[model samples]
Target: MERLSKATLPAAHTDGVTLPPSGWDTQRTGIVHMGIGAFHRAHQAVYTQDAFAATGDDRWGICGVTQRSDTVKRQLAGQDGLYGVLERAVDHTGVRVVGQVREVLFPAEQNAELMARIVDPATRVITLTVTEKGYRRNGQGGLDLADPAVAADLAGGEPVSAVGRLVRGLQARQRAGAEPITVVCCDNLASNGRVLKRLVDDFCAALGDDDLTAWIASKVTFPCTMVDRIAPATTDADWALGEQILGLHDEGLVTAELFKQWVIEDDFVAERPAWEKAGAQLTDDVEPFENMKLRILNGTHSTLAYAGALRGYPTITRTMADPELAELAAGLITEDVIPVLECPPGEDLPAYGAEVLKRFSNPALAHKTTQIAMDGSQKIPLRLLSTIRDNLAAGRNPAHAITGVAAWMAYVATPEANGLPLPIDDPMADRLAAVRGSKDALGIVENLMGIEDIFGTDLPGNTSVHDQLVDAVTALLP
Candidate 1:
């Protein structure tokens, strides 16, 4: 069997690979997307391929950008921009592999070239899945204008943060009198489009350049979106499977749940992909969808990630295989989560929760606890805290949400589980560790929430909330 490398690999985007006869391959790319992670490949790239297949519009093909990671650059470049998506279910893996990415840019390799690509008048859309912490935000959830890298970008007259990069790229296009571009944020953040806009505006404001901020606000359309796909971190098992099946060793291979969805605000400037034709809901508002996913899917995932890991479980599948954790998760979702969510017509939240559990419990997919647990500080507010806050405001019982919060705190306290050291990987890791050790859990909650940018003014010190969370953690302690 041939190993996975360009020399031995068959030509992709050809070779009988059933890609849609859309404008993707034939049309010049008009979209440049950042953060070439697994989620992007499995989710956004898949949708773009679907659109091309449906509309025969190749213009939506992606040019991926990575600020870091030489691994993706090497693998994608090696395979002629070919990669595989392993859609996992309980029974089998549905494999769809091809090349929808025409090119990739490594920031360290071609910073100026990357910026030029973004500024290209031909580029009509810029999308990002750069993760929550990639925003380089301050504690208050605003862009950190004081970040040295950003400052250097400003000093060197080029921006570095995702939003900053978009601003600079758009600035160049604006100076060139180019047409407006749509900036889509596909991260998990609620109202992510607005978050990107606020970050970009803040960056411009600190630069004392009203002209640039105004230009960005006027020309760029940052559309919020709800994107869902359970793409587990690929393991050696996956690579082995790929090699056995495809006669290749692909370092860039990604595995995901068979279920996938993208809900976007149907507003774009200039030309855009026919993604709506590809099963993506292009809507006037994505808030309902976003809220439902965040509170239900993400919230339940976090609960399992922390609580299950503490119980000596590793993968989400293994965790769900544990009847106690699985039942606890389902109970929390059905009794606590679903009641709060307004499911789409004909969409059953309970069924979705069951699907979530099934996806989490796929033994073939070893979605690590540490991977899900990374950036807990940045994640807690968006995933768990907001729902707790809303429930409290609405005079609803928030016991399960509080339990999730406690699990987060407990996970932080005991940084390792299942013979693995817990990943206290966050900007506030050191501080959180110190607080975790020094203060009581309640104090830790208060302190964590006290960070104005993270928890806002109202959430951290609520006496009732604090009491419930502390009590939950105390009860869960072995």
Candidate 2:
């Protein structure tokens, strides 16, 4: 089969596939995106293309930067930065080819070129989807100056870390007298945009560049966002399915559920795409929406990941098939999370949670429990811990939320679950290794609760929460 590219696009089958707009090639690069992964392809990239199709905007083309590897660069570049989003729903399926990504750069080898794009005055919006660990933040939520990658970047080495690269780009932009820019964070972090701005500020302060810091303060805006889509890791079967539908081999294919959403904080320092024209919500505040998703969808996702993986389920859909696990997910949302959440306007908390559970149960999306189970240390703090802390403050015992944390403790301590090796894929795996040395459930819980980064300084001293965790971990241990 001919590869999916501009050359073959003319002859490709489009009966059920959505093609890019006719003049998509005329669009110029105006957005520089970090961490060009599957989720971004299926979520933000799709929205970007829609924005172009809606307004005929020619300045919002994307230059996608691959942070950790050249794999995505090769995959996308091989096909002229073209990729397919295979949207799967229970009753329907569709495919859309995205052409908004005009360029792909691997930062390791293309640092200069990537920096050039960031410094380009045409580029007014910089978006990031780098996962939590990519930030290299210290436990106190500031730039970790001791991080080797951060330190190397600070010492004038080739930029490596996400924050490092971003700060360096801002420095170049300032020197070049570039226009003001907006930095939108599309990650799963709490107050992601605010958090990123602080990291950038911290990076600048570390370098003792008060001038650059002041320039950034005056020129840059980081807007919080709530991005949602169930884009799972595309497998061989998915690629083959795309080939069957398009009659072209697409190496850059991503699979996702049909539902998608982007809620921005209505804050930007420069011009941006007409995203609201493409079904995005641009509001004055993103906190209510952000907190709702974090505590409900993300929090329950972590719960299901740990508990489901331990139950020998490979995928979240499969886990949801189990009545007990499904009930646990529903109960966690209704009981613990909903009570603490202030419902976003025009949204019903219970109904939204039900929709989330329905999305998870979509059989076409093979969102792996093990995949969601990765990076538990970074996720637990925002997802489960916050709910726990809130419930504690309200004088309520959040058992279900406590169980989620306990499940993570057991997951970290146990090497295998249901005869399969459960890999500890956390950045803090070395620190978490201490829990494995404990003799019993209480010992493991105690050790993990001591990790100030996740539990915080206050949660560790709460005897009620600690006792609950001990009992929950004891029950969960295999």
Model 1 Cα lDDT, one tens digit per residue, 147-217: 87777777756456676676777777778888888999999998999988888888788778888778777
lDDT of 2 at 313: 82
Clashes of each: 14, 0
After TM-score superposition, the amount by which residue 430's alpha carbon in candidate 1 deviates from its true location, in angstroms, is 2.4
- Judged by lDDT against the true structure, how good is candidate 2? 0.91
After superposing candidate 2 on the true structure, give the runs of residues whose Cα lies further than 4 Å from its correct spot. Answer: 437-439
Give residue 23's error in model 1 in angstroms: 8.5
Error of 1 at 472 (Å): 1.8
The C-alpha local distance difference test score for the whole of candidate 1 amounts to: 0.77
State in Å the error of residue 61, model 2. 0.4
Error of 2 at 276 (Å): 0.3
Give the number of the best model, judged by lDDT.
2
Error of 2 at 477 (Å): 1.6
Candidates' lDDT values, in order? 0.77, 0.91
Question: Please, what is the TM-score per model?
Answer: 0.92, 0.98
